[model samples]
Target: MGAAFITPGEIIENSSNLTPGKGTIEHEGKIIAMVQGNVIIDSKSNTVSVKNDDEMPTPKVGDYLIGVVDRLGEKAATIKIIQIEGDGRSILPEHQYADIYVAGIVDRFLPAPVDAMRRRDLVRVKVTETNPVLKVNTRDDENCGVLSALCPQCGEDLYAKPEGDKNVHCPQCDYSGYRVLSNGFGQGYNLEKNGAAAYNRLKQRWSKEFDEIFKAGIPARSVLLRADHRFDGRKITRPNFEGSGGNNQRKERPKGTKLFVGGLARSIDTEKLKEIFSKHGDVIDAIVMTDKETGNSRGFGFVTYSGKASAEVAIKELHKFDLNGRKITVNNADDKSSSKREKKPSGKKIFVGGLDWNVNEKQLEKLFSKYCKVIEVSIPLNRDTGKSRGFGFVTASEDSADKAIKALDGFELNGRKIGVRESENKSKQKNNKNQRSTRELQARREEGIED
Candidate 1:
């Protein structure tokens, strides 16, 4: 063979025949291949070597690189190298990832990578090392740092703002923030100015605004931390922060009395909700659920009254009542029954249908408990919204099942008559094609009306 294929640790030739070179190593009395490649025999030097079939070009010291901010830490940032400047060859897979420390971002003191560059920012850096690990730097470089970035708030393209307190400004939103800017920022690859020199001309030290907003020692002054009035369409409403009682200890309320308030407008918050429900009786607590990422209302909440009678009054009066252009629903919060707890198949079960969206499992149990000894109650809920599916199952004593069904069937609760009957095999309904829950059907009907 002109050149033989070899694998790592495979014997290539005797040590006396061919001296070890490159991918080959001398072992005992043999020249062994150290890597998987094609074996090469150097005739002039009389040495054996291996050549990789798929070798890739790597970045060298002093070479500039283009990358995106992949991950961040308190002291450093991980950059995923996208392109090597002035080079057409691709980088090796193992050498594509690089790290840029806080010190390498700029000469000034940076608390973390977030202050200098955010995730998904396009940055330019100079390679400082290629072995052991890829290391890059942006310090004192006019062409380095962020080339392009989007506004963190409104997702609009940010423009260079040298005159503002922050280095970048969003045209579509009121977001102004700092970044380790490059000479080519907002200009793509065509750079005409020295960014580092311009940055040096501005205030070199940290400003008071920066200290209050991001510094650890001072209280957070970011707009995100404050409860401000948010505008929706033409309406304006402010979100409620839980009262400050020194510590965050919640007040004690009777168990199994929490109420679910649904179909609320996005503008409604705890304060407004409490104000509307407080007329019935003393409201212990009220909470409006909000999105974790965006900090916006999810249009539903929970309320706790001082007594069950007050809870019933709130539900009866507020369910299907209009507030802020929406028909809100109020009912008992779902909870496991505190009555006789028995395993499955221990009692007679009944199917309850035509339930109001406000009705919860606890309410169903309470209704059945009046006629018979309740064993357990189950009401399926929407996984995404945690709202009632408007139906439930109740298990009761054998003798009381028929009596309870007879008395409770067609009973008016929350302005709607509910159907209660012996439990049937629901597996067929589950297998039925194109079947949707009551809420889904209602949503689809509403969508059709809009169209």
Candidate 2:
């Protein structure tokens, strides 16, 4: 028969029969205790009577039980067993009370051992026997018993030290400290291999119970089956390697000159540009000119290289590279004369290009007057025709020249892109000297003299 509870003063006439006692009988196994006298049996109630001959199992010493750590002392630690799984039955219900004892812990050694066990440290033990005196009542202090003590530092059993010994040391860690438990065995609890097993079991039991109570209505069984089927189905899907286009479809790096990649398929943007140019080295900056009103590309843009060498390389390699069906133009960044003059902090001559054929010195000054006070606008005249060339030169104070260059470099006139660059004064000077020398030579030759 399964273990049952009985109370004292109840006459257990036989294994299956019982007589009402003067008090309430609480029975664990065959052992009956008298809880209250004048017992009355109510058939409608759940309580039942047991016979005297029914065997009762007792909790002996060296019995391994599941327990939770409750308290940690300097020399010893305490644990309380919430559930006892065996022939022995608890005097009270598992939920009503817990059993605590010192012998079941690792503190059988010294008076405050270092690295002593503490509360919430789960342990497993072999119950050697029970303390008859303490087992009489279902009280906290009465549930004490002896068990095997395992040292926390070393896996060895703790032995009693000789008289007057002040310290206990573990040879493994060479940890020497006060003993935690001085009474039953030694300091430190030896955690058993089954310690974790008990913890897992308890966790599983409680988790199952919690799920049952909180999730009773949910279709958990169906969900679990569906999940298992999905896992099984995952093996059939193969990875697609051909989905990614071949290496040729991959982007190539920009090289040589800065390419003004215009007519960009509207789909291309800054990100696409970087992907195209990143191989060249490093793209210093990339700007796509856009129409402010429509927020679309202006069909032209520029990418700057870190060095002129890379720019030159980019120009040669990528000048006419096809990008999204458009033939891109790659060249040195157009040197605008006005921009060069502005770049110089000192007053200097500026070369301007991409001018309208009709635009002359007076027209240039009128256009630039809005930006700064133009000192002069000199459109170089063709020597043969004495007509204004499309390009011209501009001179201004250093500050005004910079402002004008910035203002006019990208400004549109007659629907044409203009180029501006700083003029090399030294080269111009050397050319003028060469011309004068040649003229003097000619005159000397005519005069029949050496130059």
Best by TM-score: 1
Identify the candidate with maximal lDDT: 1
Give the runs in model 2 whose Cα sits over 4 Å from its true position.
Answer: 1-57, 74-76, 85-109, 132-451
What's each prediction's TM-score?
0.41, 0.20
For residues 1-451, could you state the per-residue lDDT of candidate 2 as single tens digits? 2234445544433323443332234354332444422223444543433434543434455444545445444333445654454444543322222333433333222222112333333333344435432111111111222222333433444333422222344444342322222222322234243221121121112234333422332222223222322322232212222323222221444443454555455556777876787677568767566664466655567787867777667766776566664446665566545643223334656778888776766678888778776666666544334445678888767777777787788677667667766666777778786555557878989999964
Residues 1-451 of candidate 1 have per-residue lDDT tens digits of 3487777789888988678987677889999876678988888889889898765456889989989988776678899998788666666556679999988887776767667787778988999988889999888778888999877665678888765448888797677778888888877776757553255233377778776445442112223222112222122222233342211224454464788888787778889998999999888888888775476778898888888899989988998676765668787785456552223567888999999999877788889999988988877665445667788889899988899999999999899999999987578677886777768879989889532
CA lDDT, every model vs. true structure: 0.76, 0.47
Q: Could you tell me the lDDT of residue 246 within candidate 2?
A: 24
